[model samples]
Target: MKSAKQRFAGRYRAPGPKRSPLITPEGAAALKAELDDLWRNKRPVITQAVGEAAALGDRSENAEYIYGKKMLREMDSRILYLQRRLDRIKVVEGTPADPNRVYFGAWVTLVDDDDNERCYRIVGADELNPSSGFISIDSPLALALIGKQLDDRVELSDLDKGYEIIAIDYKSAAAE
Candidate 1:
């Protein structure tokens, strides 16, 4: 059996190459809220539970102690990551200078060859929410649409139908 240090050693590796550090104002706010919640509300409660459990004799066989410790570790890891990321992130607000062409924070309305319409907001990688139609600027779809003006056609190899840019709006776009 591996010690906790050995067991968790491989989990701390940094993810693949860093992408853009851009984040919407809302995304940054959400991340900050999460950090605050974890730091102020959750971590303290877990720390108390772990401390109480540790006072109950042998920790090796104490399930409460072990589980509480694990939760604390995970929370600490998240808090550290959030702090680091928030420090490095750039919060992008307002519409880009060129509203006619697609750019970061633009809500792009598209129509497929079959006339199927879809709206997607080009955002930073940290703000990706497919269900909310938020896509990363680095995504293939956004990559193809970036800098393209309304009425332009976008062709991607993976898609069966070509998408045409129908609308580009930034000022009035709101988070869902």
Candidate 2:
């Protein structure tokens, strides 16, 4: 199995997995909002804390300095990540011109063999939140459900889990 470093190098380099243009306009706006919040509010708060912590300096054993610096590094990293992701993202707002087929931003309802029902919206990789009923377009379940329609039953025959797609509900409101 490929380690995380190998996977990152292979996947992020040129000619790697084609970046999916899957986010909706709303999703883009949401990402922008989060990035904005981080930069405007959170960054300054953390920066101030780090600066204050540094003033109490003992370079070797100051817990506040260590933790504050760590937090600043983490915040900067996340800000960079969001910026890079937003640059490569593509937003899909309305149902694709084809109303019959499933694509990004479509809400799909699935049923397992026992007739258990589950709903999910196909979204960008960055916005997947299973608890909130959103699934990444690049995920296995989304891959199986895409291009399918209502009343279509797709069998996800895999070793660990098996599921069926019974209904497809398109989300009119884009990802927020």
Candidate 3:
């Protein structure tokens, strides 16, 4: 039987909304650093641990064997994911020629009708994590904000809810 990683290889794309071709250089570098650390350090350590644990025999009852195997598998899967992502990613080192437009890698601030503020960075699908303040370029909010400027209001309606965003600021690292 194929391992879980084998079964998932080539069958899954980045599990997030669609994204633009551009990604911040910092974001790309961060991803590369993590991938490097995992492959060069963590993977080797986990592999050694698993090997040592398996050598103890009684695999079914061995706690280290079981847990080490699981961790090794997870690390392997993540390495594969990062490699594939790096192959397709395009890094944005600076602001685009047209600074007025909101594009991928842009830091945007929005104000809701109730005066609540939220900041988001438009990022590639692979790097999109709402908890990290990154939003996929294809997300409803990002799509609505793209090309809009400060003071512009955007209204979006879905089956269950209607929302509005007032762009407060949009800037790129190069613009800072």
Question: Quick one: best TM-score, which candidate?
Answer: 1
Query: Scored by CA lDDT, what does every candidate get?
Result: 0.91, 0.78, 0.76
TM-score of each: 0.88, 0.80, 0.76
RMSD of each: 4.0, 5.5, 5.3
Tens digit of per-residue lDDT, candidate 1, span 36-88: 99999999999999999999999999999999999999999999999999999
Number of the predicted model whose lDDT against the real structure is largest: 1
Q: What's model 1's TM-score?
A: 0.88
User: What would the TM-score be for candidate 2 when compared with the true structure?
Assistant: 0.80
Can you give the lDDT of residue 148 in candidate 3? 72
Model 2 residue 159 CA deviation in Å: 5.0
List the pairs of residues colliding in candidate 1. none
> Over 4 Å off in model 1, which ranges?
1-14, 174-176
